[model samples]
Structure formats: C-alpha cells, structure tokens
Target chain A: MTTPTSGNPRAGGGPDATGKHGRAGERGGAGRGREGDHPGQPGGAPRSLATRQAELVEALTRAKPVPEGFDAVKVAAARVALLRKRAGEVARQWPMLAAGFGDRWKASFSSWAATQPTQGSLRDGWDFARDLDGRGELPAIAGAELAEREARWSYDGSAAPRTRRGPAVRSAAGTFAVQVAGHVRIVRLSYAGTRSRKPST
Target chain B: MGAAVAVAETAYGVGIGWRPEISGFVAGLPGLRFAEVVAESVHAHGDLPDGLPALLDRGVAVVPHGVRLSLGGAEPVDPARVTHLATVAARLRAPLVSEHIAFVRAAGVEAGHLLPIPRSFEAVDAVVANVARTTAELPVPLALEPIAALFDWPDDELSEADFLTEILDRTGALLLLDVANVYANARNRGEDPLDLLNKLPLDRVAYVHVAGGAEHQGLYHDTHTDAVPQEVLDLVTELCARHRPPALILERDGDYPPAPELTAELDAIAAAAGYPAITT
Candidate 1:
C-alpha cells in the first residue's frame, strides 16, 4: 500500500473533489438526494413509462430466454446480488463512468424499480435476472474482447490516497467508474478479465 | 432480558464509534476506550483485523454493533447473521452487542437500508423472536437501539417509545440509547424523545450512542457526517446528568475535520455532564 503523497493521474484536467462535475458536497441543482426523495416530477399529465425509463431499462424483453432451469428464488437472489456486485464491479474498475451518471442514474434505478410488476412472480423473475448477472451467472465474454473493453476502463489516476501504512491495495476484482470533477476514473480490479467466470466443474 | 447478559455492567469510557475511514487509526490508537464496530462494517469488508482484538487486549473494549439484525424485519432474524455477530463479539470480548430499535430487513429481503417498522404487534413479535434467537447463545447481553426515523405510519398502533419499552420488557435486552436519535425523532416527528425516555425503564440502558445528522426538507437525515448537533448535546447533557450509563461513544462518519473538532465535541460532553475532561 504505497500511497503516493502527490500528483494523482486523474488530476489531469480532472474533477477536484470540490470541482463542479465530481464535487460531492454541491448537490443543490444536481438533486443527489434519495431516488424516492428526488424533486417532484414535471408538472403535467403523467407521461407513459417509456419516456421516463427508455434509456436505463435496456428493454430486456428481448434478452434471449435465459436458461430455464434456475429456481425463482435462485434467479431473484442472483439478480439482486449481481446488481450490487455490478455496482461493486463498477466501483472497482471504472469509477469514472459512475461519476458520469448524473441524477439520471438514481432516476434510472427508480424507474426500473417502479416498473416492478404488480405480481410477486414477475417481480421475482426480474430480480432473478439481476441477481444472476450479479452472481456472474451469465455466460462468459471472450477473453480478448473483454480485455479490450476492460483496458479502455483503465484509470490512470493520481497516486492513491496515503494511509498510515501507505496506500492499501485497491481491489481489482471488478470495474467501477466514478466521475470526479470533469474526469472519470475507471478503477479496475485485476482478474485477467476473467470476471463473471464460472468455476470449472 | 433475552438471556442474562453474562458480563457484568461496566462503562468502557468515551470513544467515537467505528467507521471504515478511521479503522486504521482506531486499530493503532490505544488511548480510546471502546469501539462500537458495526457488525456489517466487518462482514461487508472481511476478516476483522487481528489488531482489533489486540486493541481490546490493550484495554479498548471493541463491541460489535449492527444495523441489519432486522430484529423487526418482516422475517425472522437470519440465523447466519446472528452466528456471525456472536463470533465477532466473542472474539472482541465485548461485554454487550447492540442493534437499532428499527428493522432494516423485511420479509427475508434486506433493503441495505434500515426501514422503520410499523410498530405493531406483528412487528413486535417478529423483533422479539429474532432478538431472542440472536442472543440465545451469546455471552453478552444483546442491546437494542433507538434510531432517528423519517417515515411514519398514521395508523401505527404503538408509539416508538411505547414499542421500545415493551420490546425491552419482553426481551429483557439492554438498551443502547442514542441521544441523537432520540432528539432527531422528537424534532422530526414532533414527539418528545425525553418524554419517551422517561417512560423507558432506565435500568436497561447498558450504553449510549450519539452522532450528528443533517437537516433536509424539514427532516434530519442521520447522515452522521458532522459534529453532534446542539440539540443532541443538550439532551445527552441532561441524560448523563440524571443517569450516567455504562459507556458513552461519540459518532462521526464523514466531515471529520481534525482531532480538535472531535476533542471540542467531547469537551462539550464533559462540560454538560460536569465530568472532568478525559486528558488521555
């Protein structure tokens, strides 16, 4: 954990902690409050769901029927864990991209939650898909292609923050992108891009 | 009351509760008396640092506190989590373990945030059953906490204080009274925290937890990113004056300026209680 005392890589044309883009404290107009507590919806007749959620949902209605065998509980559990895991992955490898998420990310998440089917079964089904992804239950991507994209996520930031014992190891198990100021840091956890890999039988 | 807490009542002294950003500092600092290390803080991370126990050996009582026990959750307290807490507390030689009076889990679903229980019999039964199970085999008394809540149910059958009083009476658990939470609830919900505390069986107070929160949209979020607000300070000062509990810990999660800022906060605690400053 050799925490560098000075000169962060992301400091390059970067978002200083207090900078407008990545600045955490300044959420006045940005609406950084909880999703449920976000500012009131636009004043007018309510629009259909798509306009509010078009970008975030990815309309998985087309997600090729996943393997049929997983139990409902197993699937939902997998999705919740995966979403948390995916967020964790992002926090690890590409924090910069996460920073790019304006209030929209919160809204996107809210919209996804809002559309949760009225019936418990469908809601459970939705959770199953998410959890599977979180648990890395999905098929593996090609190593080479994953490496290329993963490489693009590299965060050449300033030396890590100094701890009493110097910088602790930044986990490389996944990728997370958080935006600091104007620049985004893509922190990657190292795995040779074997993330989401299934264990060999 | 769940099971007779094996350890005798003791005050470990004043110390700030645990936060991840300060773990290393806490691990190294020996002068601090007690560390209320949140259970999830350890599990969310990993193996407890060996130094943590060593810190205990050096005189710091490291108690494992938790928010997820969801004693009031829709489902029974998870047996696995209870086991984890027991292990953590035993290793730390903690005299007591604590969770909030609220439920953070629901119907087997953990929302990752503490959700308020409707304060009904169903909720009470859920909590009592879980609390009993959590402390079934523990060597320390499992403590219950009062949290600062924003949401409320008009049809809520029980008041927060009444609910807590009943839970303590039924479960016989120790109380981890958070003055800040008491004040927060009083202010936000227009209920009197002191009035609530007055109704409580003070003999159950095993420890006191206090922290800072932010005011937003006519409500205070228990953000804990700053110094203890004056409201809490006033309340604690009064509480300590009347009844000195076993231990008291100051909590600051973010915006931790420097030692002086914390020292000053502690100074106020000392002043309010008419106790001498802790020089160490």
Candidate 2:
C-alpha cells in the first residue's frame, strides 16, 4: 500500500531508506541525534518521527497494540473515540444503511470498522454495505440504495469512485437500479420473500 | 502572499460554524458578521453550497477552517490540499484560514479523526515544517488550532503551553484558540484550565471556538453534538477578560437543536464575552 512520491519533500532519500513505507521519507531528519531512543526497539537507535507517527496511526486504526511507554487505558479511549467519530460520519453518508441497523448502527459500524482504516466516509459506507451484501445480510430497505449507487458510479473498493459515462444497471436483494445520463431510477421486483417497503425517495 | 491581515483589525463579535444542516438558521442571524465553513466541503470550481453564497454576498467574513490538512503531520503538507485551501480562501475572500495542529493520517492510512502529536521537539519540527509549506501556498494568514485529546504522548518533552508557544512563535501563525478544547484537555488530565490559559499567548488569538461536549464513561469528550456546558461559557468569560479575541465562533457539529435554542446559545456566548448579541 506504499504510494511512491513525486516531487515530495522526502523524495531525496536518507536514513528513511531503511523504513518500509513511503511515509518513511516524510521525516525531514528532525531530532536526528536526540537522547531518548525509541521506546521498545532492541537497539538504542531512535526511530524517526515519521515511523513513530505511523506506528501510532496503525495502533489506533488497525487494532495494533498500543506502543510501549504509552498509557494503554488512555490509548484505548482514543481508539474508541476515533471509531465513534467514524461511525457518525459514515452514518451521515449512508443513511439507509445506518438506519437499517437502528440502535445498533454505532456498535455495528465500530465492530466492522475497528480494524479497517477509513477510506473516507463515502468509501467506508460503500465497502461496509458491500460486505453486508456479500454475507446476504444486507437490509431489504438498503438494497435499492446500494444498487442505485452501484449503477451511478463504479468503485473497485480501492480508489476513488468515478461516475459511469454510459448507462448502468445493478441489482441487489431483488431491487434493480438503472442509471443513464446521470439519472438513476430504482425499480424493485416484487417477490414472496421481498419486503414491500418502498425505496427511500 | 497577500497582505498579512492584522488579527486585531476586525472585531467580528460573535459567530457560528455554517453547517449545511443549519444553513437557514445561520443565514437568519441578522447581526452575524462572521462564520466558519469546513474547507473540504467547499468545492473550488463548482457552485458554492446553498446559503454560503448568500453569506458571502452579504459580506460576511467566512473563514475556511480546514479539518484534513493535517498540518502537524510528520509528512510535508500535501500541495494539492494546500492549493484547495488557498483557492477556497480566495473564493470566500476570507480574512484568514485556520487548521488544527494535529495529524489526521499517517503511513498512507487515514486516522479518520485528529490524533494527538507528541509535544517533543521533533514533533514541533515536523509541525513547523508542515506549516511553512502550507503558508507558502496560502494567500491568507493561517491560524493553527490546538485540538483536544483524551490522552497525551507519554514522552512529551515540553509542557502543553511551551509546545504550543514554540509552534506559534516558530511558524508566525495566529492561534485559533478553542475554549472547550482547553476545558476538555484540562479536565481529562486533572490540570487547571486557567493555568494553561494564563501561560498561552492569548494576544495571538485570531478568533475563538466555543463548542459543547459530554462525559462518556469517565472521560469528558469534546463532542460538538452536545449542549455547551456552563463551565465552557465561564472559560469564555475568563478568556475575554484577559484578551478578547476578534471573534468567537460557536461550533455545533450534529444533533442540532431548534433555532431558539441555538439563538440562546449564541446570546449566552455574547453575554459571556461581553459582545453584543448577534442572535437579534
């Protein structure tokens, strides 16, 4: 997942060459010879600020252990707070997907997103809905919503979504959505198991 | 760079964050002279959001407050983000723009929220370098805000005040002080908020943010969705007594109350800061 930098400040390589990710070069050689070595490293060599920051972010967003010398309790609180904030943002972006879970939306989103770092609200919800749909647990009411988004835009779950130039039709949970010239229409096909609830206008 | 607008020149009195959910409520403030919009929400080339253009048409000073710039990140500030912020500032004709002294992402992974950076000298260097990069592209003055964090890095080399003072001193950036953040950090850390306030360079404050929060578990979270507690208002009064900022903006992110309740909140801030009520 390391992205190569072009004309980045860190493009000129240095001690960061030993680092794994692209962000390794982000550090402008700050505190190069500081007294306090990185906490938990086998050797006494101090890691760059970029490496430490990346470790902290990994701990918070990717369910990694709290780094040494940090208060586990406080770091746990911060991790929870970050998850709560992400849940709220995603709920705003995918109202139907969130509403379908009712009182469990926050908990459900936190559980699902605890280890998975955010790709922004739009992509987070898209990925979450697609995950639920894969398990055949996607809410009936959200079927049209997901299908409509599928028709209007093409997302590979990695990069930013792009609008479809031609026409597209996508189906989920017996709900069909068609988009042409940027106009989307949802048509639900009635079936014995399908809920009769109308798609959100 | 454009002219460095003196923070003391304009006394904008009282204002609020212009969110799309409360656009009508914000626009109806007859005496409103200032408002803040999230920088990422404003499209540089497209038409402005509803009610924002009207605020600009009426000559309201809307400062573009960025949430994702991650000016305190170890990485250099993204040139594209800085360009968008500068363009949005020009589009709004803002007096200045503000962003937090916190990092939101690292290792190519977004944290999804502002995370506390260590107060070590190394962290300060990173922030200063990032700020320098950001200001180079900015057309207006940049104000750096200190965020409220539930925890502090274990290896902080400097006190909170010292860390912030060094950043502002080195970057020549104005301080967008948040009273609620002051309260939240102090309360969570068992320190006196007034102690930090006294040590900070209040005269450098370009504007102030007043937000609300509630206690979750044993910690007081700076959640803007809740009602503004009375202690935060009292801190506002304390701040103004020392050095009144040019403006104080109320920030309510979600769970918006009715208009009358919001108006009451604005009046309360005005009363605390001794500014004329803009709710009228």
Candidate 3:
C-alpha cells in the first residue's frame, strides 16, 4: 500500500492531455452566481468545481488521502475498483504478460498499478512488464512478449512509444526478438532444465 | 424546453456493442440492426478495424460511443477529441454518438475509467458547457449516459433524477440510459430502481444499455465481464413496460461468453424489451 512519492512521469500524456485553456475562471464565475443555492462551505469564497474535481481525481488516482467530507470507505472501494478495471485493460493489451501470472494476474497487476495513474493500457502493460523484468520476476513467456514489443516500438519510459521505422533487435531474459519493416519475430532460448516447464493451459 | 435537437426515433431492435473479440459472432447475428463501437478504437483516418468495414457494409447502424470525452470534467472538453469523434461518426456514417456524463480525467490526470461528478448545479453547468462544445462539432446527435458510480460526492446538491434532468434539459441531448447502471446505483444506495425510472424523461431515451454485474463487498460493480443477471433483465422488462426505447444494446466488454451464450443474452434482451430477437 506504499504510494510512489513521485507520480508516474508519463501520467497524463494521452488524448486527455489537451492544453488547459483558462476556462476554469469562466465556469467558476457561473458557479459563483449560484453559490448560495447549496450549503456546505458557507464561510469564505466557495471553492470552484474545477478545483474540487481535481482534488478528487488526485485522491482517487494517486493514493492520496480521501478528500474531506467524502466517505473514506467508499472512496477506498472505488480506488480498488479502478485498479482492478485497469488491470483488466492492461491484461488485454499484454495477454502473455497476464497469462504468465496465471490466476494471480489481477492481484499482481492491481498491486503494481495501485499508485500509477494509467498512461493508457499499452504503456501501462509495458511499464508493468519492464518493472517485473527489472526484479527478475517476469515470466519467461512474457519476456518474449516484452522483447517483441521492444523491437517493434521504441519507448523511453517518459513519452509515448513510437514505431521503429528501421530494423531493430532486442532481447529480454532468455528471449530475443527482431523487427524489420514492421514485422516482428520472437525467439525464446530455453535452458535444458527449464525447457519442459509450460504455463498452465 | 431546450434547443431543438435530433431525437433517436429509428426502431433499431436488439443490438450489441461490437468488439474485435466477438466480431464473427456479431457479424453472424441475422437480425442485428444496431451496434455501437468505441469511438477511440477506430482511426479517424486510414483503415477501419478488421470486420468493422464488413459490419458497415452489411448496413448495420453503428454508433460511436466515446469513453474519453470527459464531458463531466470541470474543464472544457478537448477539441481534438471532439473532432476525432466527429470524424469517426462521419466515417462510420453513424446515426449518432454517445458519451458518459461522468468524467474520466481531471487536472491532466487520467482516471483510466469513468468517474462520477457531484450532483450539483456547478457540475451540471460543466456538463452542459462541455456538451455544447462537443455537439457544436458533432455531425450527428449526442447522447449522454449517467455512469454507475461506486460512491456519491458528499457535496451532491441534487437528486439523481434532478441532476440528470437538468443536464438533459439544458443540453437538449438524448439519453443513453443503462438499466444495469440504474440497478447498480439503486442497489448500492438502497433506493428503488423503478423510482428513478419514474422520475426520468423516458421519451428522451436514444437507446438503452443492458449489461451484467456482480456484487463485490456489498456493492454492485457493473462489470460488463459478467453475465447479465436476471435482476437486470427484470429491470429491462420494467423499463419497457413504462416506455420502450428504440433500441436495447447488450454490452459485453470482456470475458466474452461462447457464441451461444452471447446469442442467448441478446435473445433475453429482446425478450425483455419486447423487441424482435436478433440471434436467429
């Protein structure tokens, strides 16, 4: 349940990262007109809905404390639900990585992604797989999958991945992959004793 | 009472959300006149996904359902996302497009899924403004759906019906009502699903979503991966008894059942809504 002190660098780089035009003020003004209609923060100037929404989003996605006046237990449930939903999405993008963990995929992905706001499923799976490889915990079958993706796309862990225009070759664990003209071929080098071990069907 | 907008009047009977995994099963459905595709999945240019062109070729009316417009976000909706939706609508020749009333991201951080907004006037204004910006660029009508939220904001100032009505009243947008969402929210909050249905403007329903969910830790999660429970189907029957929407769409996001199970689900929706069975 540890929160990453620094959030994912690629946290919000998708279509959702559109420039923030100064429309918050305009919307705030509209809300200000009806400030007296509701009664919760009755003392000073009312907090704008935009600001409130941003706080809620931060709490939900960043493992920050649940915002004041909200149900802590329900927000906790929502946070868990979001992580589970995200795991399912990443599993779709990286099927082999998910299959590599067998029945533990949901639990593993959920825990790893608990503090990470999604950069989209593709990058999320990539990041998760790379993290597993760093710890020597990545399943060998998933290593082949990771190797193929590395050969096909060039990702710097801080930006959106781009397809490789020229030929590329990459290796991960005991797997090797080569990509030329957008076609990727993976080769898994199995050890003598590990050759017979197969993932549960 | 709002601006004059196109209403969904076509009698598109039992429908399903088209996914790549079940493309063959969906294409094989003999009577499916309506289908919805995630707007983000289709490219604005270039080639459509496999089987999408064939679905379009078969004259199935596809509606682009957007998951990232973040209409309920307090910030202005992204123009590029709107344009992408519009372009996809034009490419698919879709009758209309739909997005959630919930926000997916805020303050440049993606929630990765729909998040509920407060049921307050300010939140309503945000949705209305975003919907205006979106519909201005849309080539067809836009339907806004209320999401099934796990929690309600503490500052909610309006009832669910009132909040949804106000947004719809201002935007003049059609409603993409999800019956499963209605059941989930009501079951979670211990309210009657039929009560909300009684208060909502049923005539504005552009279409209906019927999905499955399972209860987790005393809360009903509207996970489309599960089978459509009998309670959800019963609600569908109740919805049709009051006023049948033009279409009732079966949405299965993951854990896609075998073809026969999927066909049976579609048939069940057809049975509930009194629409002709599309599984033949």
| Per-candidate chain B TM | 0.89, 0.98, 0.98
Q: Can you write out model 1's per-residue Cα lDDT over B1-280, one digit (the tens) per residue?
A: 3333333255555666766566665655445677788775463234464457566677787788876676765455667677767877777777778887665432222243454555666667767888888878666888888776555532256877688888888888888888888887788767776787777776678778778877755666666776788888788777876777757777876567676677777667656655555534
Worst 10 residues of 2 chain A by lDDT: A1-10
Pick by TM-score: 1 or 2, better one = 2
Model 1 misplaced stretches (Cα beyond 4 Å): A1-94, A100-201, B1-8, B24-30, B43-47
Provide TM-scores for the models.
0.61, 0.90, 0.89
Candidate with the greatest lDDT versus the true structure: 2
Candidate 3 global lDDT: 0.83
* Tens-digit lDDT string for candidate 2 (A88-184): 9888778888888999999999999999887767778889999999999888888877888888777777665656788998987668887777777
Top DockQ: which candidate number? 3
Which regions of candidate 3 are displaced past 4 Å?
Answer: A1-39, A180-189, A192-201, B1-7
Rank list by lDDT: 2, 3, 1
Write down the DockQ of candidate 2.
Answer: 0.34
